[model samples]
Target: MPEQTTAAQTARADIPADGAGKPDAVVVRDALGVGIAVGLSGFAFGVTSAGSGLTVWQTCALSLLVFTGASQFALVGALAAGGNPLTAAAGAFFLGVRNAFYGLRLSQLLALPRVLRPFAAHWVIDETTAVSLAQPGRRAARIGFAVTGLSLYLLWNLTTLVGALGAEAIGDTDAWGLDAAGPAVFLALLAPMLKTGVDRAVAGLAVLLGLGLLPFLPAGVPVLLAALAAPAVLYVAGRRRGAGRGGTR
Candidate 1:
């Protein structure tokens, strides 16, 4: 009991003393800003999806329920191309499965309550992970991640409704550049989050693979291929590099 008490005291001491217990306004603002920016990508996705023949309900459902902009756009694009809904769903499912890995990492790091675990897992998306990891301080990461994720989720759903309804009367969505929104939004959202060589390598390889397979593969297949290939390549590369540096277990 004494040892446990001492350890608890030591753990508390590890928290920074200066303004450590207070909310970090700067980090919170930055986190919220990142979420808002990424949520714009969601709006862009809605616009593009609307242009691609998805109904307003479908766009809103994909944005609100699915909530992964990339997968939503991919699924919509596949459907627009007359691909099977099952095929589209499979592609979207695989791409979004990476979020489960994010949830695993976050569950260990956050140590959230069992009741809240489901909510946290749902919010563990790409932008949330990026914002959380980019936070400068330890506590800031946790608060920022949760706040940003919740904020983005709500705002994204609301704004997608706005975009979906407004897009119909805008006359040919492609003519208004709506069709280009998805790629542009993706680029903008990803550029700020990439902070490492491995991230860049994975992105570059995915892009290359996507381009290579797009012309030959069926709808949704190109991205699916790249998604599968990317992790394997990155894992092999990381292992090789670790071995070269004598850091492997």
Candidate 2:
């Protein structure tokens, strides 16, 4: 009996704990939560865009064509401030550059077929990346990415229409605290993924860099600079590990 008990205990120890069942459903739930949160921010964007002298159609076109929140905001904000068109576009373009990095990471995570990859590039934003990476496996990641991308695209456009049509009636959305919803929702979705010390460290450094640069740089440009925090942290960490290995031993 004692020998049998010892063998069973050893077997149980070797069997790894399985991930939660119903991973697809879990992915959908998380993706939807984040998608809705981020998408609804389009209300603020619409109001701001219209207030900046863009017609409703023009505002909608920006959302449709640009499909990038920070860039859209930067464009409208710059125009409203009477800044040069070229300068506004430069800032917006830099902000969107981070999406290229996201695409590289997601190309591995998603493994979508060649036919779909081009369309998928439109979905490679911060929110989609966060939700997809939070999933346990490839299937869940793809499902999460698809759900987030599709849901956000639909809701954002719809809300943009609503906000544009009622821009006068909506008054100041800032009064309603809608402006913070995007970041607040994003942090909630991202909190679970910051499980490792490295993740937390990178995030902390990013926050510091972003905030420090915000005062000196244009709105979109600071965010672009802040995106460097990831590669900077990784490079320093790699160098430290190599040093610890004593010149490749």
Candidate 3:
């Protein structure tokens, strides 16, 4: 609930102004709603994580501090299946690779100090990065991203206790579609990013590739393949469009 005045100067003064487009309270409210809405995915993750042998404290800490759904899921899944610590760590890290790409994309928009970079980097997970980059104004984007991230982090960690205690009664996650909740959240967030036909088509290609590869690939490999394929297809499509325009010109 930062004021629209010089509050920007306190922690985020380095964020460059964009043509007098400052963030309003309404934008912050919408961003908060987005965070709360997307946080349903965390409930699924929490139940899964706790049921997989993670203590309530562990699940809460990871959700609050780490704040990445896929990574937490991978960690819990690996450990539950009796994976060694090394294997579990590896699985978690692999799932976390996408966040590094998010960092690279968002680093351009951030102008914070070296000390702040660590926290900022930690906060820039998939949802935050998507919301920030998708927003229209820089201030609004920053506010949206920060508020969404903070709100989710708090709520997610708090909800893990309920999940850990309640998962037994809840029974099989697959039957309840909780397993699909995470992907549904991703799709919900993705809707805003698909503003153009090319974006939509690329997403379609990725889904098709994911479904196609699920049978042949190992547990996590199909997602990795789809991740690589979707971007490459989009890049090639963009180049073709550019080439066509050049020929016409």
State each candidate's clash count. 0, 0, 0
CA shift of 143, model 2, Å: 1.1
For each candidate in turn, the TM-score is 0.78, 0.70, 0.73
State the lDDT of candidate 3 residue by residue for 1-249, as single tens digits. Answer: 955656536544554555145456766787788778777667787788767777778878887777787677767765665666565666577668878988876765655568878888878787788777766656677777789888877776666667766788898755675655665666676688788877788788777876897676455554456666667877888899999999998
Q: Rate the local accuracy (lDDT) of all candidates.
A: 0.75, 0.78, 0.71
Report the Cα lDDT for residue 230, model 2: 86
Using TM-score as the measure, name the better of candidate 1 and candidate 3: 1
Poorest 10 consecutive residues of model 3 by lDDT? 11-20
Cα error of candidate 2 at position 106, Å? 1.2
lDDT for predicted candidate 2 compared with the true structure: 0.78
Judge candidate 3 against the unseen true structure and give its global Cα lDDT, from 0 to 1: 0.71
Residue 166 shift from truth in candidate 2, angstroms:
1.0
lDDT of 1 by residue, 225-246 (tens): 8876567777888788889889
Error of 1 at 226 (Å): 0.8
Off by over 4 Å in 2: 1-20, 172-249
Quote the lDDT for 232 in model 2.
90
lDDT of 2 by residue, 1-249 (tens): 445566545544532233345467778898998889789889888887777678999989988878888778767776766666776787778867868988987887676899999999998988898877677666778888999999999899888888788888877755665445445655675688799877998899988987898677655565567668889999989989989899778
